[model samples]
Target: MSLQTDDLLSVQDVHVGFGEFTALDGAHLHIARGGITGMVGPNGAGKSTLFNVLGGQQAHQGGRVLFDGQDITHWSVHRRAQAGLTRTFQISREMGALTVLENLLLAAPQQPGEKLWHALLNTAAARQHEAQAMAQAQALLERVGLWRLAHERADSLSGGQKKLLELCRALMLKPRLVLLDEPAAGVNPVLVSEIADFIRSLQAEGMSFAIVEHNMDMIAALCDPVYVLAQGKVLTQGSFAQVSAHAQVVEAYLGGVA
Candidate 1:
């Protein structure tokens, strides 16, 4: 299917494999800018694999990935990130030894003036940039509701808090597009709602997101034009209500809902 003008990310006939196992078979999807899109399926349905490919974490065997109209099929993960793409893993990837503020600082893209030679020769400039980065980090921490715990070690936070920190770090990069593996997994109910609200707030701010989540309720709440994957490919896509009522989706979920 062709993507509309509002689409920010597109995947066409993409295929991914691991040794003898093929995880994605001609999978296709589209995510509009400034909105949320959910990918839902049963276990081992290639949801995570597709996320990796789109994020440039894994190479695809065929097809292409386009972001903001540029082909990024061959881009490395860091390169893609530099080009305004970012993602969070299903399991939080926060460094245990780093404080929350430190994590945010690390996520900030390094400035050319932060190099050793520039720091030694242009001390004033380096310090000025450092101050700016620090201010930005503080604001992000507050935005994600983690300012009070900014100095705490990342490992000390609860699962829900870690997820929040991850979100903060992703935003610290000022990403235009974010692929979230599972923002609500392992999070408490209160925190899940907070995360959902944060997502909506970001969407309001013009960020685009592609989320892989199993929580149907969360999908119904956050996603529009949801895509359902089965056997490594898109089985169907439509509004949440439409996909929920699809006979094929119902059969895919439970032999038969009847």
Candidate 2:
């Protein structure tokens, strides 16, 4: 298939295996620029494995991955992230001991102070950069309604708050594509709505996303051109209404006719 310039991320015929087990089989999908794409499927459907492959956390045995028109199938996680792709996990991965503001600041790509020489010799530049990063972190915290908790230890935040922190940290990179693995899982209904709204607000500001979520309502409300995977392969791709009605999707999830 021809790669579109507007596709922020593309996966073409990717494959992965674990000894005798095949976790992914020729998974082909793409996240369009300025759009929220969702992935859903029954358990053991290779959703997480595919996510890992796309995020450069797993090595795929075959196929290619393209990001903003560059082949990144073999890129390192940090490399891919630097190239404008970042992701969050189903379980929050916040720094427990760090304050909320500190956690977000750490996700920013580069800091002059990060290099010993820069810290020692480039004091002026490092200070300026750190100041800018701190300002940006404060703005993001406020945007997500977490400004009041900026000084709170990350580990003290509730499950939903931790998820929000993870989301904000992913945004700290100003990523072009955010791969969210079940942003709503384990979150309260109110917080889930808040998370969904935050994503929509970001999408409006031109950030693209590829989310893997089981909340059908959330998917229906936020996604377009959803992809459904079954038994390690793509079963279908379309609007939620269309995929939910597909015979294969129904059978895969319910073991019966649609």
Q: Residue 106 in model 2: shift from native, Å?
A: 1.5
Q: Candidate 1 on 1-258: residue-level lDDT in tens?
A: 776788899999999888989899999889988889999987788999999898888888999998888888999988888889999998999999999999988888766544777667877777887788799999878877889999999999999999989888888778999989889999888889989999999899989898889888889999998999987899999999999999989888774222
Alpha-carbon local distance difference test for all models: 0.88, 0.90
Estimate, for each residue in 1-258, the C-alpha lDDT of model 2 and write its tens digit: 989887888889999999999999898988899999989998888998998998898999999999999999879998898888999987899999999999998888785235667667768877787788899999999988899999999999998899899998988888989999999988899989999999999998888999999999899999998999987899999999999999878889885224
TM-score of 2: 0.95
Number of backbone clashes in candidate 2: 0
For model 2, the superposed segments whose C-alpha errors exceed 4 Å read 112-114, 256-258
Give the range where candidate 2 is weakest over 10 consecutive residues by summed lDDT.
111-120
